[model samples]
Target: MAAPSSQIDQLADRIERLLVRYEELQRTNALLQQQVDSLTQERESLKSRLSAARARVDALLERLPTLKNAA
Candidate 1:
């Protein structure tokens, strides 16, 4: 049978490794959140610009005379 002290040492080593991996994952998660926020802001800005452009196009279309009116 293995000594109790050896088993305790093995468990401690595994715990340390798990902690390191947890920290790395936390950092990676933070980076991904930042990217998601940046993309969301960009998407909102593009949507606003598109809405403005569509409004201008609609206004211009209103000014054009229809074929029925031309006849």
Candidate 2:
């Protein structure tokens, strides 16, 4: 049979390692969440700019004379 003291020490070491891993994962998750938020904001800004550009192009096309009208 294994000694009680040695078994207790082994269990304690495993718990400490697990705690360290858990903390590292939490930090990694927080960093990923921040990245997601930044990208989402950038995507929204780009979409708004694209819409404005399309509107400007449409206005310019309307001002141009059509071939049928010119003839």
Q: Once superposed on the true structure, which residue ranges of model 1 sit more than 4 Å away at CA?
A: none
Write one digit per residue (lDDT tens) for candidate 1, span 1-71. 88999999999999999999999999999999999999999999999999999999999999999999989
Name the top TM-score candidate.
1
lDDT of 2 at 2: 82
Candidate 2 worst ten-residue window by lDDT: 1-10
* Per-residue accuracy of model 2 over 1-69 as CA lDDT, tens digit each: 889999999999999999999999999999999999999999999999999999999999999999999
The lDDT of model 2 is 0.99
Residue pairs in steric clash, candidate 2? none
> All candidates' TM-scores?
0.91, 0.88
Model 2 residue-pair collision total: 0
Q: Write down the worst ten-residue block by lDDT for model 1.
A: 1-10
